[model samples]
Target: EAGVAQSPRYKIIEKRQSVAFWCNPISGHATLYWYQQILGQGPKLLIQFQNNGVVDDSQLPKDRFSAERLKGVDSTLKIQPAKLEDSAVYLCASSLATGWAIYFGEGSWLTVV
Candidate 1:
């Protein structure tokens, strides 16, 4: 089976700019997640989608970050007015269901100057 796929593998922008990333999860997976991994830190959950419904987004910085999984197939994550601290690797992951074995994408790297 194919693993999760992410696009725009690298991006660079000035502070306060906007950027977006896309993800396509493994086939047959029912759960999708977006995570942020800052340098030297573990991945932090940003948002989670169970099918086309949002499951959790408490950790997402809604002020500037937003995500959606429409049709329960693909997802997109966007950060408007991006901040310097937002520079990191955005990871996309998927699983058969909650608590099931998860697979991850290569990640979209972001750099905010």
Candidate 2:
């Protein structure tokens, strides 16, 4: 089984610029999550998806951040007019929908200058 795949691996942007990240979770997994991990902190749940529908997005900043899983297979997260505080590693994880050990991708590290 393939693990989650995220790209660019790293990003550098100026404050208030727009950026987007992509994720491909493990096949057959029913649960997908997007987390923002600041340096030295735990991964914060930005959004969670159950198949094609969103299950939890309360932690996501609606003002500038948004994510979607169109066909329940792949997902994309975007931040418009990025802030300096938004600089962090954006990770994507997948689980068996039962709280099993979630597998994580290498993450896309965004740095806003």
Candidate 3:
């Protein structure tokens, strides 16, 4: 099966800087999510989208992070004024819908200095 695709597999930025990551989910998936995995920690759901509408974003830090799935096929996550503690692997995942098996991309790694 085809897998999720993400760009700029790795990034290094100074604190207070900004960065963005893009993702393309497998075809036909209607549910998409963005997760943050700090070093040595499990991934935490940052936001979720069902088609072009947002399903959940309670865990996302609106003050610094933002995400959108405009057409529902591709998505982007952005962080502004990134902090050192924000360093982590940003994972993009997709599934048929809620409760379905999820497939993850290789992840975009962020290192804030």
Clashes of each: 0, 0, 0
Candidate 1: clashing residue pairs, number? 0
- Ordered list by TM-score, greatest first: 1, 3, 2
Best by TM-score: 1
Encode model 3's per-residue lDDT on 8-96: one tens digit a residue.
89999999999999999999999999999998999999999999899999999999999989998999999998999999999999999
Name the better of 1 and 3 by lDDT. 1
Candidate 2: C-alpha lDDT: 0.94
TM-score of each: 0.98, 0.97, 0.97
Clashing pairs in 1: none
> What is the lDDT of every predicted structure here?
0.97, 0.94, 0.96
Error of 3 at 8 (Å): 1.0
Query: Ranking under lDDT, best-scoring first?
Result: 1, 3, 2
Runs of candidate 3 with Cα error greater than 4 angstroms are none
* Residue-wise C-alpha lDDT for candidate 2, range 1-113, written one tens digit per residue: 67899998999999989999999999988899999999999999999998989999999999999999999989999999899999999999998784777899999999999
Per-residue lDDT of candidate 1, residues 3-98 (tens digit): 899999999999999999999999999999999999999999999999999999999999999999889999999999999999999999999999
Write down the worst ten-residue block by lDDT for model 3: 1-10
Worst 10 residues of 1 by lDDT: 1-10
